[model samples]
Each structure stands twice: as structure tokens, then as C-alpha cells.
Target chain A: MNRCAVIGIGQTRHAAKRDDVSLAGLVREAALRALADAGLGFSDIDAVVIGKAPDTFEGVMMPELYLADALGAVGKPMMRVHTAGSVGGSTAIVAAHLVQAGVHKRVLTVAFEKQSESEAMWALSPKFPFQPPLLAGAGGYFAPLVRSYIRRSGAPPEVGIKVSVKDRKNALKNPYAHLLLPDISDEVVEKSPMLWDPIRYLETCPSSDGAAAMVLAAEDSLGGVTNPAWVLASEVRSEPTMFAGRDQVNPRAGRDCAKALYAGAGITEPRRQIDVAEVYVPFSWFEPMWMENLGFAPENEGWRLTLDGATSMTGDLPINPSGGVLSTNPIGASGMIRFAEAAMQVRGTAGAHQVDGAKIAMGHAYGGASQFFAMWLVGRDKP
Target chain B: MGEREIAIVSFAEVIVERSDRDDCELLLPVLKRALGDVGLTQQDIGFTVSGSSDFLGGRPFAFVMATDVLGAWPPIRESHVEMDGAFALYEAWVRLQHGDLDTALVFAFGRPSQGPLHDVMSLQLDPYYMAPLRPDALSLGALAARAALDAGLTSEDELARIAGERRGVPTSTSEPYLREPLRAHATPTLRDGAAAIVLAAGDGARALSKRPAWIRGLDHRIEPHSLGARSLTRSVSTEQAARGAGALGFGADVAELHARFAHEEPLLSRALELPASTRVNPSGGALAQDPVMVTGLCRLGHAARAVHEGAARAIAHATSGPCLQQNLVCTLEAR
Candidate 1:
């Protein structure tokens, strides 16, 4: 297979509502930025791959069809990927495969969500026959999982609070982050109302409108590009939503996905080799929960890594230096944002959040009640 | 990278005017038949992918629930596309090109019976410009049909004959128009359906079928969303995709065109440059039963079936968006 590399990355300034631009405008902004970053234009793209959570999120079914002209995909191969929350990452992986498979020399991949267009809660909680309503929204669905984690781990209550404080503070350094809370602190987090049991409002991600795009090229096509982030490996794994003995907290799909990813990249020790990480932490507790699931930390001990400041910007491995999904929760774009930020770190263009001398990084995303996983590893050097 | 040979080994679909069965229920039997056709079980598949729209189900993450049909117990390397099943098959074909994977299971399901399909499909238009105008899908088809009629590319009589022949019914030119130029016969028969196609690479493909429908070329393209911005009479995207997929030079023995509207058959036949001798829509095509998301994939399956069933070569065409704004073309040949 031909090697693939991330030649450019672009993202919108996440916000509660980007009323200034329509859905097409929002995506075009990111696509234009990505094309410019690659020192290319729309005409340079061989194909386009787009992903978003649900069409209901923006009241548009098959948005990519309408978005064809805006993305400059007219008369070119274009595809739409939808794997729920993991869609962004999955979209990127599919784009990379197109390059790796040598089908396309350059590919543009995009993911976005215009949450302001409709109530995602209403869309997600639609009542179906013989199926009970999910009135609690995403938080309600995950709070029980958090409670189970806490009960099993015996971790202190402050772990989630610490993660919330750290990530929001990190958001201050990211100009495009939606929530740059300068006043975020332990006191403020504690005062925040609890939306779900043991899950404070401050610990959850806010609904935001944004889009992220990446320009990926085959190794041979990276002639004019400098400092491209080589994609070492990409993997996606899925499991049935409900089955016997399925572990939601540390899902087998996640563990198997990580194992497959590392094995593909020939990385025996992820914690030591991976210089930085960008993981989907929609909820604060998901940081530690995903850490264990991704094999970054042992089961029940993931919180200790957070408490020890090991995941901080100045610590051993900075997680979500761009503040992650918690700070900018455009459901569809969240996963691609993680993947793009990881690439930026390796490209040494992450600006204030850049991990110093970072050569290798990991990006992870999960969706569908933690039953789906998409992960990729990028390095400064070609694999 | 070296190009790898991939072929469609098996195909199955369930089409109905309206399905009382749920998405999973509709998909289970199709999946079983698709797997059984290749003499392989779900466990034997290397990857699983699906294409569908959550909007059709009036819920979010609808495809996740549909995974129940795959019996995804041990977890699988899978992905999904919020598109026609042909796109999912494209993704699977791309995955198999990586050399590590062999067989892939692809399926698409939709039940348009839950809501007004015209209004539902209108949601696929541009929200800022087109959707607010609420131009229903049939109206768009009418507009295209009118454009083609005015351009002298086709006529009302030709459309009537195409519809009648495909539907195996008598066409009435005197019937009242459903949407100006488009009569009821010209519009698609919105239905509920599910389709599954199993793909295998190289040795696996040859092992699965006595005459595998080897995918010689597969490509898809999209056009501008605005109907006024481009010529509605011709499908530029389909022609481009046909050229890219190498379906232009070869003459197909049979063609399964996803002509959701009667007027689309002539547009696609022209775009694909199909031979006059080609037999189009032998299985009646989309006019017989248009199952939204599954209709496009069913075109591919039907075309593959021809090659698998001893035809020398065939062309499968799938379309998306309003007025044929997007198109996918695949060239299949027996090997």
C-alpha cells in the first residue's frame, strides 16, 4: 500500500452558533482553509469524503449531496461516511485509505455539525415503537456508565473535577476553542449544577457548531509539502450495541481497536512512544475512562495518571492540548478535530498547544454508546 | 501501490411496497441470503459496512441499532456511510484494496413508509436556498423531465413507453400529470427495502462463485446542487463517472440503471453511452420498487447478478440527490 500523510489541517472557530454562515458556508470555510494550508486548491483534490453525526442534527439528509459544489467535488468521486460520533475519525481513515490504496493522489475529508440548526437532544431521543425514549440525552446515557466506573475504580470524586478544570484551562490557549473559560477552577466546577448523577454540568461538553477538514496525500504526492504528518496506522472496530457481557466502560471493541492500531504501527509501548495524544473526551470522566480503554493506562488506574498531572501539557503526555471535545463539542467534527490536532502536533504547527519536539501522536474517537472505535497514529517520519 | 482485483460474489435484496418490519427485521433475511449465496457466514466476513440515512428512520444512530442483523458479538472491523449502499460497497472495495482484508459484507436499508417521502427527501436539498422552497423530489424530477423534453433529448411518449415497459403495465399518455411534465408513471414507487452484497478479493472471489462479477472499474461523481446552475437535461456527473470507471468504451450486455424516474433512463443511457442492444432494467428497475437508500445498491446487485448468471459484461448505475445531482457507475464482467 502506498503511504499516506496529512498534508494540511483546517477547522472552524467553534461557537454555540455560527449564524454568519450557512451549512455550506461553514464547511467551505474549513475546506478552503485546508486547501490553502496544503498550498493547493479545490481543483487539486481528487476526491472528497465527508462525515457528520445525523442528518437530523442539521435538518438535512445527505448533506454531502448538496455540499458537492461548495467542497469542489463536482465531477469527482465523493462519499459520505456516518458512524455516529466516531464519524469524523472514521471519515478521515476512509480518506487516508483512498490515498493508501493509490486510488487518489490527494483527498479532502471533512466533518461538521450545525447544532444550532436543531435540538440534537430531541433528535437523539426520538420515541420509537417498542423502544423506550432516551429522554436523559447523551449525558443521562453516559452518567450511569460514569457511576459504574467510579463504583468499580473507587476513585475520588475530585478526579473528574480536575480533568474539567485542566481541559477548560487548556482551552484558553486555543483561539478556535468554543469554551475558553478563563475563570474555570476547582471552586467554579464544584459550584456548577449537577446535570447527571455524579456528573456536573461543567464536566460535560457543550453543543457547538463547527467543521474540521484535512488534506491527505499519498507519499509520492507530498512533493511540495513540508513537515507532513505520516499516518502510521488507522483502525476502526465496532460491536453490537447490546450483547451479553459487553463492557461499556472499557469496551472490548475499543481495546481490540487499540491493539490492532498499535500492532499495525509496530508500537509495543504506546505510553512511552506516543509523544502526545488527542482523545474524544466529550465528558470529563471520559478522559480517564478512555485512557484505560485505549491502553494508555491500566484499568481503574487511569484517574491516577490525571491526578499525577501526567496528562497535562507540561507532563509526560499532554492529552487534548487543543482542549478536545469537552471544550468544543461539535458532535460530528469532534472526532476529526482530535485527528487533525494530533497531526498538527507532529507537524509542529499546533501553535501554543504544540507538544515540543512531538514526533508521534495518537488520535482516538468512540461513538454509539462506546460500541464504536476509530483510532490512528501519526508520526513526523514516514512509516 | 499495485491494483488488486475485487469482485461481487453474492447479492440479495427484499423489496416491498411498504414494509411492516423494522429496519433490523427487513435486513436480517437479506443478510442471511447474501451470506448464504456465497456459502459463507457472517463470521467468515473480514469487514462489515452499511449505508443508510438516519433521517428516514426519524432518529439518530439508526444504523447502530441495525447492526443487530450482523450478530456483531465479537466486535468487527466495520464502518458506515450515510449514503446509498453502493457507497458502502465502494468503501469496502477500497478497504480490500489495502491487501490485508479479503471479504466484506455491505448492506443498505430504508423504510420511507414512516413519513412523507417527498417532504423527507426534500430535506436532502440545500437548507438555505432549496429546502425552504420545499420543492418535493417528484417536482425536481418533473423539472428535469421538462428540461429534457424541451432540449429534445427525450419526449413524453418515450418516457411513457420507458415507464410502461419497466413497470410491465400499460402507460396512459392521457393520465393527469403528477408534477407538470412528470406523470404518476414517471415518478418512482417509494417503498421499503433492504439489500446486501458480499464482495471478495482475488482468490476468495474465485472460490466463492463459479463466475464472479469482477469489478473492472467503479467510480462515482457529484454535480452542482442548484438545478438552475447546470443543465438538468443531461447528467454531466454520470458521464464523468462513466469515463472514470472505464465503462465508456465497453458495451454492456445488460444495464441496471437506477432510473427512479422514467425520464432518467434516457439521460443515463446517453451518459453511459450504452449500446442500443443493451437490455436495460430486466428486473423492472427502480420504477418497479424504489426503496430509497436500497434502490441504488439494488441496481448494483442486479447488474452484478447478470454477470454472475453468465452474462459477459454489465453496467450498474446508482444515483443520488435531486435531479440526478450525483451518480455512481460500475463496470462488471464475468471472469
Candidate 2:
């Protein structure tokens, strides 16, 4: 298979409402930036792959069809991917596959969600026929999983609070982060309103409108760029939403996907080998939950890493230096942002949040009751 | 087109005017039958992907519930697309080209019968300019038909004949126009359905089926979104995709096109430059049963089946967006 690299990356300033631009303009903002970053134009792209959480999020069915002209996809191959929250990461992987499969030299992938267009809670909690109402929204569904993780891991309540504070503090350094809480502290997070049991309002990700994009090209297509983030490995795994003997907190799909990714990247020790990671931690507790799932820490021991400041910027394995989903979530774009931020770290372009001398990084995302997972490893050197 | 060779080893589908079964219920049997045809189970598949729209059922993440049908106990490498199943197949084909995976499962399901499909399809238009106007799918199709008629590319009588041929009925131009230039018969009969296909590469394909429909070339292209920006009388995207897929000169014994409207058939035929000898829509095409997301994939299935049933070569076409703004062309062969 041909090798692929992330030659360009761009994202819009995430906000609660980006009323300044239409959906077309919103995506173009990032796509144009990515094109500029790559020192190319729309004409340079061989294909376009877009992903969003759901059509209902914007009440626009298959928005990619209409955004084709806006993204300069006319007379070009354009695909739309939707695997729930992991869609953005999967979209990037799919674009990379186009290069890896020798189908295209350069591909533009974009993921976005205009949450201001509709209330995500109502959209996600729709009443289905012959089924119990899911009125609790995403937070309520995940709160129990957080509780289970806390109960099983015996992690202190302060661990979740630390993650929220650390990530929010990191958001201050990110210019495009939606929530830049410069004064974020453990006391503030602990005193916040508790929306769901064992989950405070500050611990959950905010609904923001944003878009993320990346230009993936075959290794040979890198024009003059000398420091492109080489895609080392990418994998996606899925399991049934609910079944007997299923573990929701530490999903098997996430573990299986991470195993394949690490195996492909030849990383037997993720914690020591990888310089940084941008994992999907919408809920602050998911940090430890996913840490264990990703093998960054042993079972029931992930909380120790977080409490010991192992996930902070100055730590050995810095996670989500771009503030992560909790600090700047646009739902669909959140995953791609993680992937893009990881690429930025290895490329040495992550401005204030840059992990110094970072050579290898990992990006991860999971969705749909944690049954779907997507992960990729990127490094400074070509694999 | 990559280093790895891929072919459709098995295909299965179920179409109905309307069904009480949910998405999972509609897809489980089809998935089982598709895997059974190749003497393989879910565990044997290396990769899995599906395509469906959340707007079809007005439920977010509707495709998630369908995973229960796969019984993915050990967790499988999987992905999904919001486009038609044909695109999902394209993704699967790309995955197989990675040279690690040997087989993949692709499926798609839709229930346009659950809502007013015409109006729901309008939401696919530009939100700022087109969707607010709420132009139904049939009306958009009629506008294209009108453009074709005005351009002298086709006539009302010819459209009636095309529709008649697909529906297996006699043509009569005296019918009332459903949307001026389009009669009721010229429109497709929407249905609810699901489809599944198993693809294997190289030795795996040879081991699975007696005669696999080798995919010689596959490509998809899209045109401008706005109808005013495009020449509605012709499908530029289809022509481009056909050329990219090497279907321009490839001789095919049979061709299956996802032409929901009668006028689209001739327009696509001309775009692909199919000779008169190429039998079009031998399985009656979408006019017989247009199942939104599954129609395009069913075209692929029927085309592949023709090759499996002794056809020397076949070309399958799948389309998306209004007025054929996007198109995928795949050329399959028995060799």
C-alpha cells in the first residue's frame, strides 16, 4: 500500500453559534484554510470526503450534496461519512485511504456540526415507536457509565474534577477553543451544577458550532512541505450497541481498535512511545475510562495517571493539548479536531499548546454508546 | 484499480412497497443470506460498512440499531456512510485495497415509506437557497425532464415509452402530466427495502464463488449542487465518472442503471455512451421499485448477478443528488 501524510490542517473558531456564515461558508472557512496551508488550491484536490454527526443536527439531509459547489467538489468524487461522533476521525481516515489505495493523490476531508441550528438534546432524544423514551439526552446516558467506572476503579471524585480543570486551563492557550476558561480550577468544577448524577455541568462538553478539515495526500504528492505528519496507522472498530456481557465504560471496540492501531504502528508501549495524544473525552471522566481502554494505563489504574498530572501539558503523555472535545466540541468536528490537533503536534505547528519536540501522536474518537471507535497514529517520520 | 484485485462474490436484497419491520428487521435476513451465499459468516468478514440516511426515519443514528443484526461479538473493523450503499461498497473496495483485509461486507437500508419521501428529499438541497423553497424530488425531476424536452434531447412520447418498457406496459402519450413533461408513469414507484453484498479480494474471491463479478473499474463523481448551474438535459457527472471508470469503451453485455425517472434512463445511457447492443435495465430498473438508499446498490447487485450468471461483461451505475448531480459507475466482468 502507498504511504499517506497529513499535509494540511485547518479549523474554524468554535463557538456556541456561528451565525456569521452559512453551512457552506462555515465549511469553506476550514477547507480554504487547509488548502492554503498545503500551498494548494481547490483545483489541487482530487476528491472531497465530508462527515457530520447526523442530518437532523442541521435539519439538512445529506448536506454534502449541497456543499459540493461551496467546497469546489464539482465534477469530483465526494463522499459523506456518518458513524456518529467518530465520523470526523473516520472521515480523515477515509480520505487517507484514497491516497493509500492509490485512488487519488490528494483528498480534502471536512467534518462539521452546526449545533445552533437545532437543539442537540431534542434531536438525540427523539421518541421512537415501541421503544422507551430517551429523554435524558447524551449526558444522562453516559453519567451512569461514569458512575460505573468510578465505582469499579475506586478513583476519587477529585480525578474527574482535575481533568475538567486541566483541559479547561489548556483551552486558554488555544485561540480556536470554544471555552477558554483561564480561571478554571478544581474548586470551580466541584461547585458547578450537577446535571446528571456523578456528572457536573462543567464536566460535560458544551454544544458548539464548528468545522475541521484536513488535506491528506500521497507521500509523493507533498510539493515543498518538509515536515508533514506521516500517517502511521489508522483503524476503526464497531460492536453492537447493547448485548449480553458488554462493557460500556471500557468498550471492547475501543480496545480492539487501539490494539490494531498500536500493532500497525509498532508501538508496544503507548504511554512511553507516544509523545502526545488527542483522545475523545467529551465527559471529563472519559479520560481515565478511555485511558484504560486504550492501554495507556492498566485497568482500574488510569485514574492514577490523571491524578498524578500525567495527562497535563508538562506531563510525559500529554493528552488533548488543543483543549479536547470538552473545551471546544462541535460534535461532528470534535473528532477531526482531535485528529488534526494530533497532526499539528507532530508537525510542530500547534502554537501555544504545542508539545515541545513531539515526534509521535495519537488521535482517538468513539460514538454510539461507545460501540464505535476510530484511532490513528501519526509521526514526524514516514513509516 | 489498485494493486489488489476485488470482486463481488455474493449479493442479496429485499424490496417491498412498505414493511412493518424496522431497519434491523428488514436487513438481518438479507445480511445472513449474503454471507450464506459465500459460505461465510460475520466473523469471516474482515471489514464491515453500511450506508443509510437518518432523515429517512427521522431518527438520529438510525444505522446504529442495525448493527445488532451483525452479532459483532468480538468487535469488528467497521465504518458507515450517510450516502447510498453503492458508496459504502466503494469504501469497502478501498479498504480491501489496503492488502491486509481479504473480504468485506457492505449493506444499506432505507424506509422512504415512513415519511413523505419527496419533501424529505428536498432537505438534501442547499439549505440557504433551495431547501427553504421545498422543491419535492419529483418536481426537480420534472424540471430536468422539461429541460431535456426543451433541448430536443427527448420527447413526451419517448419518455412514456421508456417508462412503459421498465414497467412492462404499453405506452400511451395521452396521460395527464404529473409535473408538465412528466406523467405518473414517468416517475419511480418508491418502496422500502434493504440490500447486502459480500466482496472478496484475490484468492479469497476465487475461493468464495464459482464465478465472481470482477470489478475492473469503479469511480464516482459529483456535479454542481444548483440545478440552474448545470445542464439538466445531460449528466456531466455520469459522463465523467463513466470515463474515469473506463466504461467509455468497455463492452458490457448488460447494464443496470439507477434511473428512478424515465427520462434519466436515456440521458444516462447517452452519457455513458452505451451501444444499442448493451441491454439496459434488464431487471426493470428503479421504475419497478425505487427504494431510495438501496436502489443504487440493487443495481450493482443485479449487474453483478448477470456476470455471475454467465454474462461476459456488465456495467452498473448508481446515482445520488437531484437531477443526477452525482454518479458512480462500476464495470464488472466474468473474467
Candidate 3:
């Protein structure tokens, strides 16, 4: 693969509702910021790739086509990617390839979701003759998984609340993160309205109207960048939605993506080498669940890390320093936010939320009954 | 950087014909054959990627059921693109180039029958501008054809000849005009089909087949979605795709095109720089078959099969999106 690096990253100020702008306008804000961050204009991009969940969520079909002009995709190679919840991560992977394949340099990738514009729950309505309606948002789907993780791993309940408080508090440092709760407390998290039994309201991610963008380039395109996160490695994996005795709580696909990513980045000890990480944890408990899945901590002891404050921004290794999807989730863009946040950490451009002395970071995302996974490791040093 | 060879170790595709299979059933078997032909199972694949569109199927996440039949046990690495499978294949190819995985399975499905496809597809245009006008896909193609006609790029008679001889249906007034400038014969028939191809790297390539259709170059580009912004008579994107695919400076043995319209054949051919002697659409091309999203990939596969079977040496060309709004070109050779 051709050498590639993340020279610029931008994200919209996530909110419950952004009625001031249309969906296209919401995305262009982020794209323009990213291009500005790279000291380039939209015309500098050679291609554009969009990532979003099902078209039903937004009532738009293949929006990259309709959005061509706003993203400066005129006469360019434009594509749209969808993979249930993991679309944002996968969308970035596709854009990275444009540069990696030597087909285009300085490719722009963006992912967005405007859930406030429509009722996503009804949009996620059960398809005829498949799974019956669980009437569960992502939190409902993962609460059982979180319960299973708690039971299988024997993690205490407080671990989840702690993460919830931690992320909301971290959101204060992020101007673009939705649900800014600077004074977030465990009591506030525990007392919030509970949508699902095990998953408290604060523990669950918000349905945000937001977008994220990144400018990926070949190594040569990085001349003026103050700091850039080189693509140490990227990997994506998937497994059957339901087979005999599938592991939905801590899926093997997530594990495989982690192992492959770590291997490619040449990091044998993830916990020791990775200084920061931004993981897709739609539910707070997923921080521990994915920590185990991503090999950042031992399977059963991942909760202890959170309990010990080992996963906090001030911890030895901070995770989700940008408040995480649990704080701001636009579904499609949530995964890319993780990827971009990780890139930001390594690039030393994380602003107020920067992980001090961070040289290596990892981004992880999963979707679809825990069947799809996309992960990447970025480093300050070029690999 | 170093050369990392990739191969189409296994391949599968349903014929570009009207199918009675349900959306899931119609798509599942094509993927099953692709994995089976390579003597591999879903578990053998490290990554999975798919291509498809919801508009074509009248339901969103239309490609989701593919995971059920693909045996996504224990969860697998997966992604999907809302485009043709050819681009999905390109994404898989890039994954392999990064040396993270050696083998991958790429698949795509579309059933044009599931909805009022042309009317639904018009939604892909700018909603505020084009959708307000209700510019159906037929009218768009007709608009492009009219531009060609006005430019003397082709004639209605020539278009009919290409449609009749190659497409098996020539333009006729009897069929009634769906759009004013487009004749019934020149427009491609609405179709339903699925396709899949297996990609492998290096030794995995050699192990898959005696004659692997090694992809020398592959790429795709898109013109703007607006009709007013582009010169519909010629495809600058197709030419760029061909140039990036490294297929033509001079010539090739064959050019299997995916043009759905009669005039589009000449339009795309001139863009790709196909020699006059080069055999074009020997297998009757998209004129004989087109399964919407699957047609572009089927064309590439047709040319690849031709090369694999010793029917051609080097093959090039592809068509996708509205009025060839997007184009892909790949050179394949027996190795």
C-alpha cells in the first residue's frame, strides 16, 4: 500500500437537534474545517467518500451523489458506504484506499447522521420475516450484551456509571462533542432516566445530529502539516449475524480486528504501547467490553482498569478523551469520530482534550449484532 | 513500498436475467458459489465487503441479508458501499494491498423489479433542483442521447442498430416514450441480478487457479450527478478511469462495455480509446443483460472470464451510475 497519513480532521458541534442547517449543510461544515485544517480547499481533494447507516434513517438514497457539490465532489470519484453501525469506520477505510491505491492523493472522507430530522427508531423498524421488533435502540440491543459481559467477566455495576461520568465530564473539554456535562457525577448518571434496565440514560449514547471529516493524503502531500498521524495500520472484519453459539457480547470479529490491527502496527503489547484510544462505545459498559475485545486489558479484568481510573484522560492510558460515542453519537459519524479522535491524539492536535505526550493511539468501532468491526492504529512516527 | 500481488481466486455471479429468487435468496446463492468455487468457506475469509443500493430494492440495508447466508459466525470483518460491486471489489483490493489480510470476498446485489426503479433512482439527484422536476433515469438518458443527437455524435437510426443488434431490443415508438428524447430500444431494460468475486494476495492467488485473471490496473471515477454540469455526450470520467487503469494508450484485444443505452456504446468506446478492430461486446454485453447494480461488475467479470478462457488477451471498460456518471476500467490478463 502507498504510504498514507491523516493530515487534518474536523467534526461538527454535535447536538440533539441542528435545525439551522440541512443534512448537506451539516456535513459541509465539518468538511470545510478539515480542508482548512489541511490548508487545502475542497478543490484540493481528489475524491470523496461518505459513510452513513441505512438510507431509511435519513430518507435519502446514496446521498454522496446528491451531496456531490457541497463536498466539492464535482468531476471526482465519489462513493457512499453503509455497514449498519460500523459504517463510519469503514467509510474512512475506503477513503484511505484512494490514497493508498495511488489513485488519488488528499482524499476527503465524511460521515454524518441527522437523527433529529426523523425518528430513527421507526426507521430501524423490523424488516418483515426476519427478526421481530425488539423496539430497542442500540442501547437496548447492547444492554443484554453488557449484562452478559458483566456476568461473564464478573465486572461490578459501578464500572459502567464511572465510564458514563468520565465521558460526559470529558465532553466538557470537547467543543464539538454533544451532551457537554462538565459537572457530570455518578449520581447524575445513576439517577438519569433509564431507557433499558441495565443501561442507564447517561450510560447510553445520545442520538446526535452531527458530521465528521478527515483529509487523508499520501506521505508526499504532508509537506506543510505541523503534525500528522501516519496510518500505522487499519483492519476491518465481520462474522455471521447469528450462527450456532455466536459470541455477541465480546465478538471474535472485534477480537480479530484488534489482533490484526495490533499486528500491522507492530505492537505486541497494546496496553503498554498505546497511549490513547477512542473506541465506539454506544453504551458506557462497552468501554470495558471493547477494552477486553481490543486486548487493551485482560478479558475479566477490564472493569478493574476503569475502577482503578486506568482508562481516564489522566490515567496511564486514556481512552475516549473526546467524550466518545457514549457522549455524542451521530451513528454514521460516530465511528469516524473515534478514528479521527485517535488520529488527533497522535497528531498532537486534540486541542483541550489532548492526551499529554501521546505518540500512539488506536480507534475501534463495531456494528450489526456485534458482527462487523473496523479498527486502526496511528502513530506519530511513520511506519 | 513493495509490490503485493492480488488475485481473483474465486468468482460467482447470477446471470443478468430476471430472477424469481427473493432478494436474499437471489443474492445469497451467488455469494455461496463464489466461496465454494474457491474451495473456501465464509470462515476462510478474513474480510467481507459488499456493494448495493436501497433504491433499487425498495428497502434499506437490502444487502444486510447477505451476511445471514454468508455465515457470519463469530462475526467477521465487514463493510458495504452504496455503489456497484466493482467499487466494492476495489475496496477489498485495497484491504489486501495493506497486507492485513490475504483473502477477501466481495459481493453485490440489486433487483430492479422490487420498485419503480427509474422513478426511485431519480431521488439520487439533487432533491431541491432535479427531484423537484421529477427527472427519471430514462429522461436523463434521453437528455444525454439528445445532446449526442444535437452534436451529431450519433443518430437515432444508429442508436437503434446498436440497441437492436447488440441490446436485443432496438428503439421503437411502439414501446411508447418513457422520456421524450430516449427511444425504448436505446434504453436498457430494467433488470435484477447479483454478483460476487473472491480476491486473494500472492501465494493465495497461485493456489486459487492455474490461470488467475490478474488485474493489471483498476480504478473508477464519477462525473457530477447534475446533467446540466456535464457534457453528457462524452464521459471525461470514463477516460480518466481508463487512463488510471493503464488499459489504453494504443489498443487492447477486447473491450467488454457496460453501456445500457445504444448511443452510450459509441460514447464510452471513444472515451476508452478502443481500437476499431478490438472486439466489443462479443458476449452481447449489457444489451443482452443488465441487472442494474450488478451489470457493471458482470461486464468486468465477462471480460475477465474471456481472458481466463483464452478468448481474449487483455480486456478493459465498464459503466455505472446514471448516463455513465461513474465509470471503471480494469485490464485483465491470463497469468
lDDT of each: 0.91, 0.92, 0.81
What DockQ was computed for model 2? 0.90
List the DockQ of the predictions in order.
Answer: 0.78, 0.90, 0.53
**Candidate 1 docking: what grade?**
medium
Instruction: Show how many residue pairs clash in every candidate, following the order shown.
Output: 0, 0, 14
Between prediction 1 and prediction 3, the one with superior TM-score is 1
Task: List ranges where model 2 is wrong by over 4 Å.
Answer: A129-133
Number of the top candidate by DockQ? 2
**lDDT (tens digit, per residue) of candidate 1 on A1-383:** 88999998999988999999988899999999998899999988999999999888888889998899999998898999999899899999999999999899999999999999998876777667755356678887888999999999988999999999989988899989999889899999989999988889899999999999999999888758889999999999998877667789889999999999999999999889999999999889999998899888999999998999999999898999999888998899999999999999999999988889999999989998888899999999978
Say which candidate scores most in lDDT. 2
Model 1 over residues B83-202: C-alpha lDDT tens digits? 899989999999999999999999999999989988888888888888899988888888888888999999899989999999999998999999989999988888999999999999
Worst 10 residues of 3 chain A by lDDT: A125-134
Q: Estimate each model's TM-score.
A: 0.99, 0.99, 0.93
State the lDDT of candidate 3 residue by residue for A52-155, as single tens digits: 98776776667777687788877676778898788899889888877886667789999999889677766665565665343665666667788888899888
Ranked by lDDT, the better of candidates 2 and 3 is 2
Over 4 Å off, model 1: A130-133
- lDDT per residue as tens, model 3, B3-83: 467767666777645677776788778888888887888889867888888777555567767778777764677778888
